[model samples]
Target: MTHISTTNPATEETIATYDVMTSDVAFDKIEKCHEAFLEWRTKSHADRAPYLRKIAAALRDNADAFATLMTEETGKLLRDGQTEVKLCAQIFEYTAEHGPEILADEDRKHSGGEKRGMITYAPIGVIYSIQPWNFPVYQPVRVLASNLMAGNGVILKHASICTGSGLMLRDVCMKAGLPEGLFDVVIVDHDTSDAMIENKLVRGVTMTGSDGGGRHIGQVATKNLKKSVLELGSNDAYLVLEDADIELAVKTCVQGRLYNNSETCVSAKRFVVTEAVYDAFTSAFVEQMKAIRLGDPTAEDTQLGPLSSAEQFDTISEQVSKSVEGGAEVLCGGSAPDRTGYYYPATVLANCQPGTPAYDDEIFGPVAAIIKAKDDADAMRIANDSRYGLGGGIFSKDEDKALQLARDHFDTGMVRINSFGAADPNMPFGGVKDSGFGREHGGFGMKEFVNTKAIYLP
Candidate 1:
């Protein structure tokens, strides 16, 4: 049997190994999940709340262990891992608290009020979730909690690097009163995963990864006539306007970029600075980015952690090299320290023109690309220049102008005004254009895989 081994990216220490399942085994598991869904779909939304609540409690109870495992597996900062655990718990709690209402049957008028109709959101079937390693706990939970509450069984195909986290999540759900086979994590290869997506038992699919991967899976699911929700990658831009407070912009941009070691899909990757404050913002941002020392993720004093894997380290390093070759200037960090683990320092690049990775592609690490804009209008233009529209930010002392820009002109699904955050349960999270379609969180996800059936009464 082929086995997958997980390692601590910070220390390059092997953590655990697990055997991969055959396509047949995975298919059989899907059959079992469909059976569970058959029974689960009979329950009212209220009946599902208790299960989610218990899972949330279990997550909190085991927060430290889960955080430790995440740190060991992906080199996530301990504090960030702990926060991820909390966020996962909150997601479960949020689903439990609000799912019933979100999925509640609604009365409506049809035929110009001549007929009364009731629209019901019904569970489809098994939902196949393809999640990434970056935010392992939260990524799976975003789909799992909502789907379970909506009365669908969920199967998670997490990234190979964080296999343990996926299995551990399944264990927690089972122990927290989730019915057996209702939520399962499959240890299978990509080919098996595609086969599972084409399985009749799986009614829908959700994926979080690169646009390239999203397109492949989305096509497969579409070919199978299955519904799909894809939350893909992004090269999100954060703009510092002429009237912005350089201190806040610098600090928030750094936090946004370095969060999760900058592996996040929605994190700030591009900085568009208006000429008025270009000098101030770039100077402070580069200085602060330089001061962030890469060290042991488990250490409290360490401000920056290693990339998630040796592959990730190499990818970031190469991207930086190519960006510099393509006329981008490394303002702060451009080289990885000779270390035991997959360590890459916080880096900032300027003079980032088009046709470079720093200018157009998503560099999934602690590297920041700075683009100079002629003015505020040019900054917005630069921010919207990318093919990606997952999330972006605008920092201006004018709250009204920032809100207006985010609401009207900012061409992303989500925008943060003068602040930085990964996600909030109360807000919808997803992206547009190359970032992919569909929204998750704030009740949007609960309906993504459900069937909207309209019942009419004459």
Candidate 2:
């Protein structure tokens, strides 16, 4: 394909088209980005702080326009898109405020306290980031802010569906005084992307996608001995323990499953309920899932929007069908609505056995899998059965018990006790197992692509 086109998932209409760039052009841009990094690397961490502040300001200034574009391009709800912009701005602000202290040189005594050792975090070269479409603005911004603060150039290979959002982000940064070529958005296909990964100029690669995709990228980067961070998929399980608050569990599980049109990687996908409260929890959970108001993303009252594309809609539909055929029973919605856009109804599945997609795979849609457990111990066992361990939740009126389960028993990277929420800039993010490795946010991402040099003073 010579060009890439952006489509409105809600309207199924073409929003815009972008001409694809050749490998030669992408290489030239990479070279220029490296040159820019050469200059940026000379700046101290304190000197790099104001640029992030300026970028944060630019994001806020264009929040409305950028949010609308994201909604049109990816079927993100208008309110959600606006919130995403704000979160991206907040990430920049957090990095700006904390980066200097986080990356400052540390003096240590070595050789029996006779020699002084100085450790410095220095920027590497260009970092290539391949991001997904779920949180268009926030995904790229999280990477860009920390790396820029670390004085590294960045190249974004955003999902084709949200190309407009990618360009809009770059434009906002450039307008905020980011140097030209310091951050570039490449318009290319996956083949070109893979080749670009092997380029000598790019010092590191970070990607957010499925485990399969993560494996491919990690292999390519590792083959060339380049560092990579993979934030992959998750089939997060929210356990409704025997002592759980039925009402709170129902409400939070519903909110977690349905947020972001139920496409979030770490959002609640499996609901493991203890038999003592299984019936009560499923009854209210299914009712709420069925009550979700799916409509145009721009509307104020719409609780859910369409899937990001027809392909996504079909994939979710197939997963549901296969799960049902494999013995899962639909408690509420089980099919797509008879509508013009790529819309799938919020669905609830019970009698989910281990052989079915609802139980075994990560269904990236608004379909909740309700699994019955013998007790609280069995519920934790079921939750830990999954191969992916990204994020999860444990609900119980006994805060101490819930905290213990989250801390000692839960196998996920992040476990929310008696609550449900997404990314917070102050907290560490990323997961283990098939969900991928490495940490982001909370000052960890700034060091992912940096050179930690040890200076020995004689």
Candidate 3:
């Protein structure tokens, strides 16, 4: 079985080759992970932190190489890719720094003098991780670092295009001095993955991908009576009230969408603007979008890279076409670049209707769907109508009012008022509804990989 094959999204050309894991090897790796789980669970969080720190050191030591490889594999800018590695380090370091305290027994006494109780954390065994190509490095590390720190073994089934990222992460773990099988990377296509999910050795599952991917995994995990943590795609709204700063909102919108070539799950998909400043916001947004530099992801000056894969380019292109037909006025950049990889120029749309495909559908490209509303109520209504509720942003001069509106109205799991949000090592990031379930970062992240045990000590 072939484990890997080299391909570039930029030139749409074969770069190299790799091996794939057959079912037999996949099962063996699962078995090893299950066996390794027993030993890994014996260590304390204190013991785990040193290993995590070593992983952090290794990530910093090999930042450039890892970033270059990541850029080659996933078509993110080298700086972005390097930044991902640094975040991966922070995932480990944060878990190492805080996991122990969170997992430590909490001494709580009932005010009614009922009893005293202590809560403890335990390894939940081998977790099946299915990650996407967009965040080839940080996604897996977010789940894996917390899992390892909490004393659980991890079995990664990474994106075929980003198989190298998973392998490289394992190498980093080994370099950090983890025991064999504690963090195993298995290569398997989709169907074979289903088989592994049913395996008794695999006790839990977590995924970071599209809504469809999350739902499919959710079904599998539910049928098998296992746990799952998902970080799915979001048609997250960026609400720009009439009182909003045109410059700040425009700048943040461009930053959010163009970052990752708009391959991010939580990229601001819709722009909900009140009619008062709608034209100014739209003009400023288009101007900024035009200013974004699209070049080889490896280049330092590149602000945007090609879509990570040929398939994604087609889907995004089709989405843009269909959205335009559904009544969105294409303001700029609705076509692919004449380049090697799957390159689409940044696009901006105006006159987007509430029920239009462009309005609710997640824009996974450099396209921003603009939905104009007569008033704040209409803006809120449009923003809250999406089935997806992952992450959202609000821009307004009345920060307090905007926050309250977001808190009360938006259905997303997290909100960034006047700022573009990403996975912060210290914050819990997740989603609701079609965007998937469970959390991937911070305290919630560490808990995802562990089994909680209660001790009643009176």
Give me the runs in candidate 1 sitting further than 4 Å from their true place.
none
Residue-by-residue lDDT tens digits, candidate 2, 120-224: 999999999999999999999989999999999999999999999999999999999999999999999888999899999999999999999999999999999
Residue 71 lDDT, candidate 2, scale 0-100: 93
- Per-residue C-alpha lDDT of model 3 across residues 79-162, encoded as one tens digit per residue: 988888888888888888998887776676664758887777878789999988888888888888888877889999888888
User: Would you list the clashing residue pairs of candidate 2?
Assistant: none
Which candidate, 2 or 3, has the higher lDDT? 2
Find the 10 residues in a row with the least total lDDT in model 1. Answer: 330-339
- Per-residue lDDT of 331-396 in model 1, one digit per residue for the tens? 888888887999888899999989999999999999999999999999999999999999999999
lDDT of 3 at 40: 79
> Please, what is the TM-score per model?
0.99, 0.99, 0.96
By descending lDDT, how would the candidates be arranged? 1, 2, 3
